[model samples]
Target: MSTPEASAVSDEVTTYIANRIGFIELERPKALNALSTGMIRGMHAALDAWREDPDVLAVVVRSQHPRAFCAGGDIRFLYESFQRGDEAARDTFFIEEYRLNHAIFTYPKPYIALMNGVVMGGGMGISQGAHRTGGLRVVTGSTRIAMPETRIGLFPDVGAGWFLARTPGALGRYLAVTGETIGPADALYAGLADAYIDDTALPALVDTLRSEVFERGVDVVACVERETAAHKVVPTPDTSPLADTRAFIDRHFALPDVAQILASLEAVSGCEEAEWAEQIVGVLRERSPLSMAVSLEVVTRAEGAMADCLRRDLDLTRTSFAHGDVVEGIRARIIDKDNAPRWRFARIEEVRADDVAQMFESPWPAAEHPLADLQG
Candidate 1:
């Protein structure tokens, strides 16, 4: 076998191309490789180089951290940047991050993601885009994925509107409002992952890929599928909490309005699923009312092309920083550890239709839009 050659981009991430494979590893274990703006820039540079390299037939993305592929973006950085009144700081992050997302989503060669541990927020932004492109998404028993952004006063902005909107029934709405975590079995059931292979087999799987001979005509996903099948186990569908809550999620979340969704849950407050209903209602109450309302509207309006949804998200991201609850949410939950946020709206009922509508409008013209270059 040929020896592998690799290059270090930064301490946070590393890149290498060996034997027809391009490997990008997120390397900040202490922070679980939480994406800083520099880390995003590094991955983008690697992808840009590999996109044109004929020698690189496939790309494998994973983290050096054993416990988490990535927890999310560097929220502490975002908070501090916003506080310092650095006008370009937050904008630069989202603009470049979303562009990186579009690049990964539309990359021509096979992009394989070894999603080993906690994947959420920006982590989902990167992984889910690859999953949508027929790329390999290998999950393990250790994999825990969620889009729990509403808890921190932000909507699920990293293409959640595009992909989650298309999930069966109103399950996307349920996930948006409640911020529930799902394991590998539920992830597969939700169409968020391609295969579930145990953590113990990961090294062997990587070795097989590294040593295997490559043919130009071979189907990448099929090749990966065959390799993973040797280690794949049938996860119990009943073990998934999402599976248990399916009927309740679909029925109540199908309501057109947020108020109606709440009313539907409240009406069922005394039924057999009363405890579940109340718990959901309580979660909604604790989250930023503006965030919950805007998230509902964001996902509800996610009806167009993926690029279009991303463009819409850029608008929401900008607006949220200007007038939304990001500061309060981060301050209470992350900084103070108080578990209490004094949101702009005291109650869900206080979030009016116009307030939600304002978030969906674009602040810039089509030509001037930062994401105007997105192809797909």
Candidate 2:
């Protein structure tokens, strides 16, 4: 067996090749592997190097953190940058992050993600793209997943508008607006994960990848499938709570806008699902009204290609920083820990249609857009 020479791609990211498999590991345990600009660049650089390397047949990504695969992006960095009036820094981070997401989405090799623990926000950006490219997304019982951006005054970005839009029925809209956490069963039910294996089996799976021999024309996905199936624990038929509420979720979330959805939920006062409806109402009430409105618009309008959704995200993010409630939301939630965000609109109904329309408007001309070079 050839010993893999591990190299630090960045302070927080490490990459190596063993047994013809490229491995990218997130090492920022303190931050739950929350991505920084440097980390994003490092991961992308490793992928780019491995993309055309004939010796490397597949790639796997995992986190060194025991509690999280990746929690999200470095939002504190963005908040601090905003405080410092360094808009350029914030813009650069999003631009590079989105590019990395696109790279992962379009990678020709089998890109596998070991989604073991907390996977949210930017975490989804890097991992969700695997589904479209014949990649494997492995989840464990401990895995907890959510976009959870609307809670902090941002809509789900980092190409979420694309992937979330494609989830089972109106489940994507439910996730986008509520920002609720779901476990492995719900993740699997929602098409967010490919396989489930015991957390104890993860190390053995990695060992298999390191030790197994791969002849030319080997099926990497099948290799992973074989390893995962060895330790697979089939979930109970009713394990997914999300699946149980699918009809209820679709009924309310399929409405035209946030206000209508809230009204529908509020009107369910004496129904069998009243508690769930009331809980959803409470969640929506706590979120930024403007963010919910913008999120609905983004998810509903997200169509065509991944690049198109990413481009739309970029535009909305710019507008969000400029005139939306993100800064205050961050202040209340992360900075002050107050949990009391004074959103621009007192109610979802007050979010003007014109304001949401302006968010969708691109800051730059189509030819001059930052992601113009990105293709479907």
Candidate 3:
């Protein structure tokens, strides 16, 4: 848990600033920078300190590897706690994680996520929330992002409803349900990424910031341009595989519910994106049936402001874990990787309307709710 040097990260943590640009680099590359409670606490403490510090201006968040900016939250640890029946442990992680998310959303300074690679589920949540709720004003996340939470038996949390509801077209539900990877091109179009710099350019960008050469009206776009010039990944929707993907998504997900949609996809003929539909449909088929249903209910019903949606999300998340896809999916994917998840309900048809109702039933008494103290 060593603290970071000005630009170089330590074994578990790193912190430093040069030219008014600060960075908090996650150093546990082997873990793919998957956030544990310890890591979350470390990041929380670091960002809190930076909030009021004057010398540290714009903060750049990155990691020590190419594989991921962060793969996701440390679900392995959560699964263990989950199996051990450690409610306190689970609550500590989720509560703190959400608190950190809320803080990042409202953080007072410019927070730039150096989303180099392998951003997914929990990774997307943390990075996604940094998009311009506004403090020091320079806030950004990435289309380098992907919220594949549902794929692994989790829902899209961390203001997902907030960001996705605002995303173009019907993409929110498409990504939520299918957990497909959107590259730099789609990332730009989806507003998930602000700038599409090539991954190799990261070191140079860091070096520039570390060199004490920054100026007022410091050209972030120019920096991005210099780095990304050689490898500009432009999104061409006409030529995009996303067009067919989009159509299939709208066709299936646009239906009234998961059951009807799955049935429709199964029966559809001559789908232009047949293979694409089948691939994504397979992902949906692999997902937890009950969790999938709960998510459709949550995302579509998300209303009011981002905060309101998040609060509702907390309830849905808590209830879902108690009775949804998390533990089963975790066992199949991580604990065993057998890919044979014996979901509570074998199929969406088995997920009765009452079952969906029960899934939304909050486990925590109002006073003991996980996010009771959150401002939203």
TM-score per candidate: 0.95, 0.97, 0.87
Ranking by TM-score: 2, 1, 3
Residue 298 shift from truth in candidate 2, angstroms: 1.4
Task: Quickly count the clashes in candidate 2.
Answer: 0
Residues 1-376 of candidate 2: C-alpha lDDT, one tens digit per residue? 5689545566798998888888999999899999999999999999998889888888889986779999999999999998999989999999999999999999888899999889999999989988876878888878889989888899999898787788898999999999999888888888888888888888888887888788632477778888877664346424678888999999999998999999999999777899999889999999999999999888898877889889888988888988899999999999999998998898998888888898888989999999999998
Residue ranges of candidate 1 with Cα displaced over 4 Å: 217-220, 231-235
**lDDT value, residue 287 of candidate 3:** 81
Global lDDT of each model? Answer: 0.82, 0.88, 0.68
Put down candidate 3 lDDT per residue, 1-376, tens digits, no spaces.
2233445344676767556666778877888788888877877887787777776666677875777778778888988987888878877887787777787877766677777667776676667655663312111223346777766677777667677666667777777666678766676566676555656567776776666444531343245445555555644533445654666666677787888878877776575656665666687788888777777766776656665566666777677668778888888888899988888877778888888788667667877776666664
Backbone clashes in model 2, listed as residue pairs: none
What lDDT does candidate 2 reach at residue 127? Answer: 94
Q: Which stretches of candidate 2 lie over 4 Å from their true place?
A: 216-218, 232-238
- lDDT, residue 220, candidate 1: 54
